[model samples]
Target: MGRVLSVNAREFEEWMQRSLAACEAALDGFVPIDAPVGLGVAMRYAVLDGGKRLRPLLVLATCEAVDGDREAAMRAACAVELIHAYSLVHDDMPCMDDDVLRRGKPTVHVQFGEAQAMLAGDAMQALAFDVLTPDSGVAPALQARLCALLARSAGHAGMAGGQAIDLASVGLSLDEATLRDMHRRKTGVLLQASVMMGAACAETPARATAALAEYGAALGLAFQVVDDILDVTQDSEVLGKTAGKDQDANKPTYVSLMGLEPARALAQELRCQAQQALADSGLPNTAWLSMLADMVVERDN
Candidate 1:
């Protein structure tokens, strides 16, 4: 059993600020401003100026861990964020979660009409791949690998498949195993793919890649568990989204299934698992990854 080393809080905060600034700039530069019919505005609205950019940070951090190519990692970071943003757009629509608020602002469908929001999501999804497959800088082979990883994670086998299960399972009793499976596809895969994509930016060894995958999976599940906890414990103003929506919708969550204290315990357990994976990875610089795992589980909103 491996252990998580202590991370300097001030150092982590400084790194986070720098990484976030870079990611925001990359996203703004990559997302176009000249699409026809006001589409560019909606696309930018959905992607820019909101959210924690956790996925992008994960991509960048893992890339640093492996000493990977900064250009490819940055592209991958922006691409993953695009996929995540697109998913949030569609997920908040009337046909889905029907959310009216996201990231403390009106949902995309509310800001833009539902039809426009739909198109924005569609365009962002396409643009994710476009960001990955630039005409220059990134090698063709590396581009292909990054695209394949993102596509599979965002496609039916990953996020979409998990969402399908989620919609159908609403108001239904889901055992722990079934619930885990649903979330693993819906949320975990993308987060895991972020790590793998970063690793792909350079020639990471097999052992390190495997360990990072394990770390990503554990951190992803831990993220959702903490989210469930926040839904019940935090309010909308604090959470920046609808609070208690899961319980209101009769959706099964870790908190609903296992009670609040147990769910909290589970989150800590998963965080430990993530830290253990990082320790096992044999990569020298995993301070950021370890701190991220802590941040995922300990986040207030």
Candidate 2:
């Protein structure tokens, strides 16, 4: 039902590069450089540079797809990214995953003490909402919608809930259905919310909104499936994080539950579902969304 464009790989790459640059610049400006006791420094370190910025890209792509407000989309993009960064900061703490490296650099806890890292995460989580509710340009109604979408995705019902399940499931053997539910909450909801928040920036048809929701859900799960695959097949230097850590922690991942080849197949299947959802969205320009789905499944890192 959608209008398909003749987009090639080169064009998609150029668009991705431009989008990523804009996101990085916006994040650099939005994340503060000053807070009491060097808190700002740690926050900036955790958010400013590194990582794929997939969530922001999804927000921007969906905004463009919906012909939404660019200003609102940018703010939503940054807000979702801030929440993701905060989660990573907390997840890498000594009591959590106890990771030393993230994004190919020492984790916030490693570089800045544990207390500072924890505080940095807390600040970033609060800052995400602050970014959403700006004084001007964005409408109050849109602000509230964006805030609500973000809060639901990051709160107990979404990412935090998933994390709790992850922590508890460590060393426990979770079946495929249970693992899917956990990842759907922990990793998938926020990504899905990114798409929804972007769509919220403007008025969209109910049909398109529903289709995009399906697209986001499929794409989010595909991303995590790829992550599980990369964890075992790739190395620390390649992954920018400790490789095999999931296995080391005995965490139940798609790769663990379904086997590596089957996990890879599932990622491909999910990518197909995401593309089909976009096709069903009936939007004129969803080339970026289509390409991003491919990127998520095919990405090496």
lDDT string for model 2 (1-301, tens) is 3445559999988988998899889888998888998999999999987999999999999999999999999999999999999999999999999999999999999999999999999999999999999999999999999999999999999999999999999899899889999999999999999999989987999999999999999998998999999999999999999999999999999988989999999998998889889889888999999988988998989
- Tens-digit lDDT track of model 1 for 1-301: 7655566899999999999999999999988889989999999999999998999999999999999999999999999999999999999999999999899999999998999999999999999999999999999999999999999999999999999999999999999999999989999999999999999998999999999999999999998889989999999999889999989999999998999999999999999899899999999899999999888988899
lDDT of 1 at 81: 98
Once model 2 is optimally superposed onto the true structure by TM-score, how far is the C-alpha of residue 276 displaced, in angstroms?
0.5
Candidate 2 clashing pairs, residues 3+ apart or interchain = none
C-alpha TM-scores of all predictions: 0.98, 0.98
lDDT of 2: 0.93
Which regions of candidate 1 fall more than 4 Å away from where they truly are? 1-6
lDDT of the candidates, in the order given: 0.94, 0.93
